[model samples]
Target chain A: MLFDNTDFDYEISFLKIPGSDFNKEIRDSKFLSPEEGFLRGNLMKDEYVPYKNLTYFKLTPQNEQETLLLKLMAYSFTINDLNLYLDLNPKDQQTYELFKKYVKEKNRLEEMYSEKYGPMTITETQGSNYNWIMDPWPWDNTGGSMYV
Target chain B: MFKYVKHLNYPINIKKKDLKMAKYLLTQFGGANGELAASLRYFSQKFSMPDEKGKSLLNDIATEELGHCEMICTMVHQLTENATIEELKAAGLGSMYTEHGKGIYPSDSFGNPFTVTYFAVTGDVLADLSEDMAAEQKARATYENLINMTDDQDVIGILLFLRQREIVHFNRFKELYDYYKKKGY
Candidate 1:
């Protein structure tokens, strides 16, 4: 369900809703009434809607390594999600095994990506001062698309 | 004020319909391992935190937990938007809707509401940090449980993001614990 640059704008529009309060709880308590609780649960599972325009990066020889590194990160997220889901629903033993397999594959790919481009660092080296790395932030395309 | 400090924010777009997930996610939101409980637990324990660094770490982690609460609520709202009564019932959300009627609220996946006892504000830094670390692991496990039940990639993606944060936060607390111990506090 990865939305490309064309659809990223559409998704951002929905994300810009103003004055919405999703964290409100019942009075003097964290529990919602049964009806309220159930309704809230259902709301959390809605489909993705595009809200903003997105810009796609052109793949270049210099960026090939960076691109693969980003892809590995996306894969890492997928594996993490699949692993968590398997824990919630153990009834699907086969799916669980598949998720485990994918996790291993993702790990292998991540290792390859790292070897090719060097590890993604939280810190960057300049002439002297070691500064925290920035860019490809969470909201950026490098965070990867929600739809994949 | 580090120039490169990352400003933590909820990363996804939440819709009106996602409230149901908010309710269920609230189980963790205010439940034993939920952010509300985790925040209070850390904040309360900060009083006895041995050093300035330890106290600062506790404050930072507790504040981050608040953001996690916001993120979960955003997911809940997005999932429950423009939902019908029939749709809500089918999703096992009838109980919560009876009271809030499409409003956002926090409760367990099973509809049991949040209780204060879900968190303890112990004043001991070691005891509190240890509890905080364990809480993060429990939350990671819970996220794993949530991920297993759903086939939705978006939902799974968000849960994965959250689970990773849990691991990161656990590591942060562990570091703080070690620092405190090394200082003999």
Candidate 2:
């Protein structure tokens, strides 16, 4: 349908924000940090999202550790989204590099989180005991222990 | 083969405990066109998928469907969270309560457990991809039906997200099918 209109400008246009080259700048400037906030994901860094973002739930007691957990979650979402993009545009180097970077960041954050909190994955369990089933189980609305 | 994401794809915080509505929602949890069946179908279908593109796409979509399943189960759980045996009996969930007792069981609203009869994993690339498109549409219709039956805003929100996801998955599979057809595969 995109090509059906026959009014193709044929311009090589990349994703951009209104005032600035958003895609060009985000490569080096965007990051997963506390002040930047992980709750927004790539949606914010790429596009200037309005106040009404995608997140529907608010986390209680925003702390450094909690921020880290949210960062990992955000990075994972970014990677997952990028993976889908790459499935079709596999040769897009820019996105492929971003995907790799996010995967690394996500792994580091997951490790740090698992070390301090409980293991987010089975491989993160350091002790002899299988701690994957300790608590939370993803359905506990207010529970902190079951972050994946 | 997969890692838990620790959070639902979208937050589901339903506050109501409507057991009749719960029965309706249960159809989405493990019904024929439910999330569990969607995930199982894609995951099982990937083994016979001809190329890596189809395999990985199916894997990720299937994984997302599991998260959808989790969200549906959470909704079902919260709805029945406070219902007592007597209350459940009145609500016609007495048999379900007797079997699972406030826990989630992978079954339809009618208590039919998940079965492979709901899906297929035929090794044909075109046929499997075509089936996926049909599955996504079917799941979307089921969610739309649930949305129509519900008055709870929270349930409606999650159902909307799930329905949108079904549409997305359908489009993706359609793209893959088009690619195969173009290549004369």
Best by DockQ, which number?
A: 2
Which CAPRI tier for candidate 2? incorrect
After best superposition, candidate 2 residue A4: deviation in angstroms?
30
lDDT computed for candidate 1: 0.53
Q: How do the residues B17-113 of candidate 2 rate in per-residue lDDT, one tens digit apiece?
A: 8898888788777889999989988998889777778878888888878877888888888788888888899989999888888888888878998
Question: What is the alpha-carbon lDDT for the whole of candidate 2?
Answer: 0.68
Off by over 4 Å in 1: A1-148, B1-10, B14-23
Least accurate 10 contiguous residues by lDDT in model 1 chain A: A39-48
- Residue B80, model 1: lDDT of 75
Best by TM-score: 2
Question: What would the per-residue lDDT of candidate 1 be over residues B1-185, giving only the tens digit for each residue?
Answer: 22221222323533234444555675766566677777777777767776666666666666656666766665665577568889888877888789878665666777666676776667777777788889888987888777665556556656755665676567667867776677776
lDDT of 2 by residue, A14-78 (tens): 11125655434554654322112222222324332221122222333257665666556556656
| DockQ values, each candidate | 0.03, 0.15
Error of 2 at B18 (Å): 2.9
- Per-residue CA lDDT of model 1 for A1-148, tens digit only, reads 3335333231222112245332232223222221222211211122112212211221122255544443454444444333333333447776566557556765675556545433343342322433334343323323322212
